[model samples]
Target: MSCSDPRGISLGPRQIADGVYWVGVNDCLKDLFESLWPIPDGVSYNAYAVVGSEGAAIIDGVDEHLTYEYVEKIREVVGDLGRVKYIVINHLEPDHHASTPRLLELAENAVVLVSTVGARILESLYRVPRERIVEVKDGERVSLGDKTLRFVYTPWLHWPETMMTYLEEGGVLFSCDAFGSYGALVRGIFDDEVDLDYYLEEAKRYFSNIVFKYSKNVLEAVDKIEKLGLEIRILAPSHGPVYRKRISEIISLYRDLSLPKPCARATVVYGSMYGRTEEVVQTIERVLERSGVSVDLVDAARTHPSYTLSLVAESAAVVFVFPTYDASVFPPVREVINYLHVKQAGRGRLAAVVNTFSWGPSAKEAVDALSRAGFQILEPVVSTKSLPSPEDRRKIEELAERLSSELRKFGSCA
Candidate 1:
């Protein structure tokens, strides 16, 4: 759906079983990409409605603007908005909790369910009443009629209070952001019904932008869930469309991302003051490409950090090219390097540093930062002043040779 559609409400009511439904609220926030840290294509806010014999329960709520539409859809399906007995806040993220206050007011007797950490965040952030909150521990189950809702605490899957809710009878897991992506599924909400390639790209972008930093915690949380041995018939995440089939594939994808899998490729990202460092990056790209190694040339000034992190996560090596200014690497390149270090993105990868300066120790300093970040240095760093002479080119060739050798070793392992 176009962004400007005033009635841009895309909702889904997929029946899980008798008297149960998976309600998907699509693209609840308008212009979600504009607000993302490094920007995204778009995103959806998925909320589920579970109908039972006694009453109904809404798993999560969309943003303020979409709450009324969400309430209306529930009323349409269940015949009454007042019958919603529980509002389970799987995550207190704004996209999921912004409309919660209004929903609680409408649901009257419906209790707001969340983890203790989630409750604290909601009270501090949204001023949600403490008495209305129902704190659930990990593996805690709450019965809503014939179906039981089980809460699994998954902290730092991007946020501390994040958790997943599973419908015991339905075998549907409402994963807040664990297997989520950007972009709403306009026509359908299941993986089998949509274009897998497009969704996978969005998923990668989402993980790269929002979840890559907390990858360690993600792995731990995934392991915890696996130990529970719940029969997962569908994977419903808050941001992206649901996975009604191939649930194992999505779980495997997340598991793989949590592990280290490096390719025999190098990404040379550089920021240049003038043409000097740019020349070096171009030379390195050509040198690597000629040796039958894949290379990605990213101008740090133009490429976003999210895409760069993705490439770093996939590559066997990363070459940082910088122009020295006042005994420091260029700001953009420096920022990227620092982020990579902080996120530990260069794990199990070879790295090399190159710098262009009039006369300074900036190249050595930049190389030191990469070394401290746990990158295995493949060669002595290359530095140039004014322009590279034949000797400088020869040094670059040697550095390229060292890098190629490292990649060859990595290839043999693969």
Candidate 2:
């Protein structure tokens, strides 16, 4: 699908379901998402417009930078701005609601709808009169003539005030940032129209980087939906393509990602100030490969933590190889460990350490960090002096054998 539109919009407003139009914007200009994770495929800020028999509502808003085009897309769907009576904010993250100020200016008659927490936080972010803000509770229903909007509280799906809007008549769930992905929707608007393979990986990466920390909350939110028995026909997230044909597939994928199960693969996350530590890593990789163990080798100096977090979170075992520096852990390796903790990637996982030092052997720092991150440290915390000697190489091979044996026991989740 071509990603160009004559009006400079990446995609024109497209219909996802009856009376529900996608007013999302593809942001190819930004190199990163949240000024952190890289977005080589770009990202999308998805918004939606739901037209009812009596009144119209816009679900979420695009980034502030895309305000003009966003409002224009709404105009394309709603025709008259005055017809918009509600601006439902599922999540108030700037990426989703930054353009709301300008959008409210255009739709002067529209009232802002938010959850209880959203009401408190939205006031801090935007200037809206008390009468204009309607705070809804979980399971609360708002009437839009023929269509009814149900609010489901799904906090920490990245933020405290996050929630989802369910359209009763259309069986559409407007989940902002919950079932989201990173890549821009350049191909098409719906899941059936786009390439599923590419978007799924982007979604996994998005989950690993952004939502993995609140994975328990994500599972809770999913359970809430299940217990309530909400039949979601269309999953309209704040980013990526809308899921219509494969709603169940994305929902299942999200559930699996949220629950950290042991996969057979191992992720080798390492940092090397010099060539010494990398040489040890090479030996370990070769042994693991020859033993028929699948491995993902990530150089902490070169790879971003977001990508590594994705691999480590799913892998059953994670091996850290870094040289001790200044009588402490290597800085880059420490950064990766910090991110692993924040992402909760080490929870219920096995970890091993290979420390190389020219002066002092400082395996304490690596062990403490990994233990704090909830990794079950394996035996033989191999420490070497600068580079591996013949004896050190034997120890390394022993460590590899242990890892290979343990990895074989843990089955793959792929």
Candidate 3:
């Protein structure tokens, strides 16, 4: 059984395990996710359905805009909508649970399951009432005939009330947003069926952009699960792949990203208005490349902060180059820095600043911004006027050399 979307692609529920189907929706039409992050590769709002001999439950929901398509997918899987007994809301984020209210209208027999705190704000967020909502505490379990599900309170998984639902018999963990990625499923939905490399990389970006801010919470959640001795045979996140074969790999990656054992890579981000700062960035990029130091360059003026944050997450070092504007750090660069600071980025990283100005240098503004973002600013902040003179070029080289040497010292010996 298949369902149609605006892209003319046939997407239907794929049985990920016995009695468990991935009834998710992919939105290829949205240019931007949440109207901010760029989704050039598109993204999926994944949901799942679990059927037992006695009852059926669906985990998560898609965006409200595609209510009909999502409901149709549910129908395809369950046949009669009345058979749907439970609508499990792991997280109350709109992209995941926005379709719940509409689903509730049809599934008259269904009762909404959510976290205790989720119950408080459920009505305010989706207008789902308390009567239909059953708030679950941590370690609480509900059985649907032969299959059993447990709720674990994993708060601050980017939201205060977020939780993950664990299926007992099959050992499936429907992690709400953890281990999520940006790309939509194409050839298949499971790790074995899709391109593992692409999804894993996207998962890294997704973690950095969405979940890494609450890395401590992620670690706690993982630890909690381990202490419970729950065998998570499958990682059924609300987005991206349903990891079965590579369960340990995904879990290990999240732990590393959570602790943020940063690689010896660097991110060179800059906004050049009149090409002077561009000259410095080009010089730095060349030096980094020559040293065999893996690096990512982001043009802050053109690229969104959503991308910049992801690039910076994996980098052990960040070099910010920008021209001073209005006697302050360049607006675009400043904005990116602010976003990083707000997200508590730069936990284990080094930073360098290069400023170009027509009159007085604004190198201090850039340095102060990075400092507020928790970066350890390296020495020799380079500043140039109009264009880089011989002295400015020499200082730029020194800074690049220092950064490259630092990367090598941090285990990226290559």
lDDT on C-alpha atoms for all candidate structures: 0.77, 0.87, 0.86
User: Where does the lowest 10-residue lDDT sum fall in candidate 1?
Assistant: 1-10
The deviation in Å at residue 239 for candidate 1 is 1.6
Clashing residue pairs in candidate 1 are none
lDDT of 2 by residue, 1-414 (tens): 223433233479998889999988988778878998988877889999999988899999988898999999999999999999999999988898889888887898998899899898987887877888888899999888998999999998889999999999899999899888888787777887777788898899999999988999999999998898998999999988899899889999999998866656789989987688999899999998887788899998899888988887788888999988888888878888899888774466888899999879888899998899998998888899985789988998899889988988866445
Segments in model 3 whose C-alpha atoms lie over 4 Å from true places: 1-9, 286-292, 344-348, 389-391
Task: Give the Å shift of residue 156 in candidate 1.
Answer: 1.9
lDDT of 1 by residue, 262-381 (tens): 556888989986787888888888888887788888888898776787777767789988888777888888988887887654465688988888877487777788888888877778
User: lDDT rank, highest first?
Assistant: 2, 3, 1
TM-scores for every predicted model: 0.89, 0.94, 0.92
Please tell me which model should have the higher TM-score, number 2 or number 3. 2
Off by over 4 Å in 2: 1-9, 412-414
Clashes of each: 0, 1, 0
Leading candidate by TM-score: 2
**Most accurate candidate by lDDT:** 2
Worst 10 residues of 3 by lDDT: 1-10
Question: Cα deviation in Å at residue 44, candidate 1?
Answer: 0.6
